[model samples]
Target: MGGLLGVLLVWRVASALFGGGEPGLPSGGGTPASPTPTDDGGNGVPASTVEVAEDFPLPAIGTRLEFKILGLGDDPKRCEAVGLLVGDDQRTAYHHLCGDAEAGTDVYFFLVRIVNHSDAAQPIALASFEMTADGGDTLPALDVETANATREHYFPERIELGPDSRIKKFVAFDGSPPFTPARLTYVDGTQALVIHLRGTWIGA
Candidate 1:
């Protein structure tokens, strides 16, 4: 029974990562449409989906993070970093970049939204995710209590999502210097997901 349970567990994680739906690529021969810009100046900053080339294949078991620019309160002298995931596709991770220069802090708040596209329920743990910087620094995610104390937005520990259902939570990281982050990574034993941010500016 123990061995059976272990096999079952691995199967679930695999399903969550690969997903059961068709690939997110265009089906016809024509190129995919360009992502529409959603920047209305409501937040005093432009917002738009980063355009991936039509031929860029979506990662089989990974997520994408997109950053946004937010005005810092009434202080026109200060800037606030904000972002969100590109789409609501299941099995894809989403994230936001946040930091306070005055406080000498910068961090990545990853909102991992897992949807069980498989037939059974899948259990996920925070231990399955990892964040690393360009300088070979392996950053540790803050515990729920510590993250909550530091930022108003944070996610709790483990989670489980049923088939056709989804759950979203935040994972906080203090990996690199403010606006100097290089890469983000996630692993689920069988597969690995890496998001590259080299040569990218935070509030640009």
Candidate 2:
């Protein structure tokens, strides 16, 4: 989880560094977050090499996406590099998150990772789903429609990639308030799950 937390810390710092605020940012009312940015240099990787995989499938009924973590790391929060290959498909991105377990901390650990690749803010919802791990033990699927117990939307006030100096790295925040979650459709084309799972449901 250390790696994930580091990534989250990077987000918090990057967001602040790049100024992802409303006129300033959403957390202007809270205690002045005195977050510090460590590591003057990055992981020896060029910023130009940073890539955004655009073909990863959004979780929708009738859509079954297969992925495997090519690398796994832990630093308080876990870091996972997921690999994906489909019928002649080779596009992919690293799904990273930071997990923390402090009582009443109100932090999100990227329970699931997603990217914004749409021009217009598209409507996507999560369904409470059942996923099998290794064998048969089932867990909440990443994105289920009606059954989805959580939801988050990404309508960035800006989307210029690195145009906003505030977006220093691949950053994500959990449960920003006033979030309007979308609905979902079942595989059979029927409505199965419905309702808005609050930000707390997804952690944040």
TM-score of each: 0.47, 0.24
Give the per-residue lDDT of model 2 (tens digit) for 1-204.
333233343332223222212221122222212222222213221233221111122222111221111111222324332323334433222333333423332222222222233343322233322222223232322221122212222212233322112221221322222122222111111212111121211111
Clashes of each: 1, 25
Instruction: Give the Cα RMSD of candidate 1.
Output: 16.2
lDDT of 1 at 152: 23
Give the runs in model 1 whose Cα sits over 4 Å from its true position: 1-79, 82-102, 146-153, 175-179, 202-204
- Model 1 C-alpha lDDT per residue in residues 101-182, reported as the tens digit of each score: 2233444444444445566666665665555555555665555553214232344456565766655445656523543444
The TM-score of predicted model 1 comes to 0.47
lDDT of each: 0.37, 0.24
Superposed by TM-score, candidate 1 places the C-alpha of residue 77 at a distance from the truth, in angstroms, of 12
